[model samples]
Each structure stands twice: as structure tokens, then as C-alpha cells.
Target: MIVGGAIFQLCWVVRDIAVAQQAFTEQYGVADWFSIPDVHFGTESAELRGVPTDYTISVALGYAGGQQLELIEPRDGVSLYSEQLERIGPGLHHAAWVPDDYDAALTEACAAGIEIVARGRFDDIGMEFAYLDGGSIGSYIELMRLSEEMKAMFDHLIPAGFTNPWQ
Candidate 1:
């Protein structure tokens, strides 16, 4: 296993987050999405292919069984999300994990020959993340480390019955 555990989230890139959310709710039984309509990943906060890049996206997050489901609508700027949406119009984009040791886990992935396509820190939320190339799998692998505050926020947003194991 790359991160040595179960995947916590699966994300899909889409043209419209609202439509995608409805489709997922109806087709895959995922309901109760917590949406953030405008998220700005500025050049100061993000990178693409090791170079500073900016992007904006709207996302709806929910749960499907035990895993978190994310639907992203690329709004502006060049990013992995936008690129994937262009290359393979609106579908599965990545599988993700929130490992306990972020740096160590990242180093291990790099040592294993997984290329780091992008990495950045969301200082406002005390979170850091990276996207690793999933060449053979035809998707990216996301590794994230969240702060206690962010975990608490997620816990609050999740429906009463759902769980966030990482939190």
C-alpha cells in the first residue's frame, strides 16, 4: 500500500458541482453535501508541477459509505483539477489519505518513486497537502494533513450519523 491504509476520500472533477452533486445523490446514494462555492488556491498557497500556480474551484463534499466523496468544479486558473477535467471530462480524479505523519509519509512516497506533481499549504486552515502521480492507475493520489481546528470543522459539518476516522 502506498500510504499503508484505507483510502479516506475519492474525488471527481466536474464541469458543474451542483449537477454532479445531484447526480451523485441520486445515482450513488451520497447525500448531505457540505459545499464551499468559492475556494481560492492562490499562487502563494499552491503549486503545480513544482511551480507556483493559482486556481479557483467550487467543491461539494459528502460521504458514500465510509469514504468521503468530493465533487470539484474548476472555476479558474491552471491546475491538476482543470487539466484532468480537460483530459478526461468529469470523472474519477483521485483517491486520498490523511496520514498521521505528513512529511514522513510524503518522503516515503517520494522514495518509492512516486512523483510529486503538486504540493501546498493552506495556512489559514493549518493544512498541508500534496498530489502524487498515479500513472498506472490513471488518477492522482492525494495526501493531506489537517490541523485539529480543521478536523473539528469537518466533524461539525458531517451529518450526525457519519464518521470521520481521520478526525
Candidate 2:
């Protein structure tokens, strides 16, 4: 399995994306990166084996130093994020890592005893991601692999922002 990209970002699912964003700005001094609508898929679209489901949601992205923070809020039915929010009340939903070989990484994670919680694409970003069992790691882990077109889009869009953390 592929390794070594490092923790790329952290996500938090909240009841209200705007409220969470404000809280983050006040608590961590992070700035808003962007916000987008998203969808989740599963047996029932939002059902979790051990938690509740969080379906169609809105996410706000923010940046601090070299890491990103995502605030997710349900826009429709139940979803994984909604489940987390129900249990924990809007905080530290997951951590993300970038991998070159996503399939191989998933294989490795499974071999290492991590469950594949969900897998899907972010159409807006042209990227795909997988969420592994949080119970195993004490928190959820997300692995992202961006397509070439997505990388190009990010390269162009990110520079337009007020802060370029990677630089």
C-alpha cells in the first residue's frame, strides 16, 4: 500500500456549518477556504453501521498553517457526518491523508484491521475519497486521491485566495 503523504486535513461535522466556521475562526484563527454542497452514499445513503447517517450536506473549508479544516452540516437526511454530530456534538470528525495509490492504500488499511466506512467523489473538486473506520483509530481517517484535472483546478484556484498556506 502507498504511504507517507502525511495528514492533509481535518474535518468536523457540525449542526450548522456557519456556526462551526465562526467558532473555528475565533478558537483557532483559521480563515475560510471555501464552501460546497456534498452527497454521501451507502446502504441507505446516510446509514452507518455503528452510528447514524448524515446525507446531503454543506461543507465549509478553512485553512490554518498547512492543514485544512472542514465543517460539515447536513442539508438533507442522515449521513455519516450527521451521525458523528449526533454522538459528539460537532467536533473533530475525521483526518485526511493523500495517497498516490488509493486502492493499494485501502487494501493496506483493511489488512491492518481498518474498516472501509464509505467511498465517494466530490464532483466539485474532481476528487475521490474513502473513509476508514474511526473506531479503530479513535477517530475517522480519510484518504484522498485527486485527478489530474482536479490538481490543475486547485493549482489555479488556490493562488487566487488571500493566503497560500503551502507557500
Candidate 3:
């Protein structure tokens, strides 16, 4: 049986990662947790079933109220986020959740009628993700699971605002 996890992070899709990061820093007084350049994988080209085509993705991480915030920018062609940005102008993209049995959970979600919008594996992070159609929810949803190595990496590189006062 697949054990579901809580919402891990909320993603904000933007056109400019630097501007977005700076805005967040200035507005919320939060520093960037980490920023990664465009990372490519698998085929050089692909298509989103119901969404637009995209090539590369650039991501930045930040924190607010004890929750991680992911910022994504599509570098290649049009993408799901491109449409989202056109409609809403760079804001919340999706809420992410982690599941113990990612495959099983995906299967169950499909069985229950949630459509898979997009999916890919982040080789550097040792994690895979799937975006689900939200229907009436007005937002996409992400399902993700991390490998042990990735978990170790996260533990080693703590985000800036995570200092423990007692320590």
C-alpha cells in the first residue's frame, strides 16, 4: 500500500528567477535556499498531453513560514507554466506531495480519474515528479518521491533559515 505524505512545497512559476528571488527576498526577508540552472534530461524534445511544449526548466528554492517554496522558469518553448503565467502572471503553480509508493499512488490516482498532466525525473536530485490535473481546484498538483541519496543531500545542505535556537 502506498503511504501518502503531506504537501511538501508550493511552486511559483516565473519568467525570471532572479527577479522573483529578489522580490521574495525583499518582500519576505527570506534568502534563497538554493538556485539551480537549467537541467536537461532524457529526450531533447517532448510534448505535454494537454499542456504546451517545453524544453528546459530552471528552478530556485526558498522558504516561508517553515515551508519550502519552489520557483520554476521554462527556458525552452511554451510550457504549462507559460499558459499559467499568461493567465495569472507568475504566481502559485502547484502544491507538491510525496508518496512512499509513487508508482502505486499514481496508478490509484489515474484509476480514480485524476489525469496526469506532466511527469519527469530530476536525475541530479534523484527524484521523479508527476503533475496532476486539478479539474475544479483551479491549480495543478504535484506528486513526488525522493531517493535516499537525495534525502541525505537535503539533510546535509540545510536551507538558510532552518537554524535551531537550542543548538
Top candidate when judged by lDDT against the true structure: 1
lDDT by residue (tens digit), candidate 2, 83-109:
776787767888887776778998898
Error of 1 at 75 (Å): 0.3
Question: What's the TM-score of each model vs. the native?
Answer: 0.93, 0.77, 0.81
Off by over 4 Å in 2: 38-54, 123-125, 156-167
Superposition-based RMSD of candidate 1 using all C-alpha atoms, in angstroms? 1.5
Tens digits of per-residue lDDT, candidate 3, 1-167, equal: 32344566789999899988898899987664688898554343334664435467788877675567889987765667777877888888998877767889899888888888877776666888788888898789887878878656554455655631111
Off by over 4 Å in 3: 1-4, 41-47, 50-54, 157-167
Question: Which candidate should be chosen as best, given TM-score against the real structure?
Answer: 1
Q: Measured by TM-score, how close is model 3 to the native structure?
A: 0.81
| Candidate rank order under TM-score | 1, 3, 2
CA error at residue 38 for candidate 1, angstroms: 1.7
